[model samples]
Target: MRKFIILSAFAATLFVSCDDTRKVLHEQYLEYVMHTDSLDVVHDAMTVHHDALKTDTRTLAQKLKDVEETDSIAIADLAKHQVLLKEQATSLSKLKKLIESHADVKSYFMSDSISVEQMEAQLVEMEANNTDIAARLTQIKTELKMIEAEQESLKKTEKH
Candidate 1:
């Protein structure tokens, strides 16, 4: 009877050890799945943003052909559109980096909102780049309008 009890205890210990390993493996599987899903979402968002940026860039190119400095109205509108494009591009880049860096997902997530610190830092840098791009774009648009106005006035004088 004493030997039987000792054997039972040993068997229970082995079972517990196996259970712990299985749990760890399960958690790793779950993490991989979750990470993949998050990356998919990021990729989709990036694609959409990329498309939008292409459209905005095309619009700016077309606008440059027709908008003059004299037409302050169109100039301001184009600047605003450019700013929006810059913002979208920044957001797409940040999400892409985040997805790429997050190879591991914790099983005990206190909040679904948790994120990797390095990824977040990359995102912040992207945002700063966007801000600078926006400012530069605004300046260029202002200069473009001035040149357009001068050209329009020259054309007007020639017509006279």
Candidate 2:
């Protein structure tokens, strides 16, 4: 009958609609997984960089403490610089902790109902921050090496 045909057509349309919806959701889920993986990779790299900076700061501090010429103005300047480096290192540590506390990036995105574009924006921001930190760390390390070389030169002059 005409009624029977119409009813069957309606059922088929609903079924197709449900299938399409599911396909869209599955694609979205895959994209989310990829984003989560990218975030994890970036976070891990940041953590490693942070740890290296902390270690370098500690070593430099120890060397400063061991320097024998406390009265030298150069040594004083180096000590001041070392203090600043320590402060920066402490700030970095706090940042690392904060990031770790929000390690579940996927949950954060889901809980806030953030769109994929927003998540990508955040990821880019994180990458930029990491790059900035890395540049700063490199600069600090170079300064520390120069200071060490100067200290050695001073020691040689004093021996003469």
Candidate 3:
């Protein structure tokens, strides 16, 4: 009878230990997945913002050239170009600030103690803002081209 009791107790202890071990392993796996996701978000955000800044800078330079070359430019038209220039400058400044912030995020993400949830949230918001800025840059380029076309039309009318 004593032998039977000892056998049952040994089996119960083994079962409990196994369950505990499984729980710990599952929790660790989840933590690893979340950490990896956060790192991916930060990396993707940085790449997209870098590409956008490069393209926007090129577009702004071309617009500036057009503004400078405009002949017999009306004061109102010049004012419009100046406003667009100011807007482009502001966008460029914002992009520069984002580049600086990206470095900080990268450093923070490297630490295990940092909150992955908050980092992901911030990265998502930053990506949305960057996309908006890129769209605005495209719109500005289209408007600048329209202005150039109008100036050319005026010149041709004057020639005739």
Q: Which is the leading candidate under lDDT?
A: 2
Output the TM-score of candidate 1: 0.40
TM-score of predicted structure 3: 0.45
lDDT of each: 0.51, 0.56, 0.54
How many clashes does each candidate structure show, in the order listed? 5, 0, 0
Write model 3 residue lDDT over 1-160, tens digit each, in one string: 8999999999999888865654554454345445445544543554454345445444544554466553444434545655655665565566555545545555455444444455556556556655555565556556556655654554454344
Candidate order, lDDT descending: 2, 3, 1
Clashing pairs in 3: none
Candidate 1: minimum summed lDDT over ten consecutive residues — where?
Answer: 103-112
Model 3's lDDT to the true fold? 0.54
In model 2, which range of ten residues has the least summed lDDT?
A: 95-104
> Against the hidden reference, what TM-scores do the models get?
0.40, 0.45, 0.45
| Stretches > 4 Å off in candidate 1 | 1-35, 38-42, 45-49, 64-74, 104-160
lDDT tens digits by residue: candidate 2, 1-160: 9999999999999988866654554455456455445544554664465456446545644664576754466556556656655765665565555444334554664443665466556566555655554555556456556655655664555455
RMSD of each: 12.1, 7.2, 10.3
Give one digit per residue, the lDDT tens place, for model 1 in 56-148: 445554656554443555455556656655665665566555544433333322232433343345345434544544454345345445544
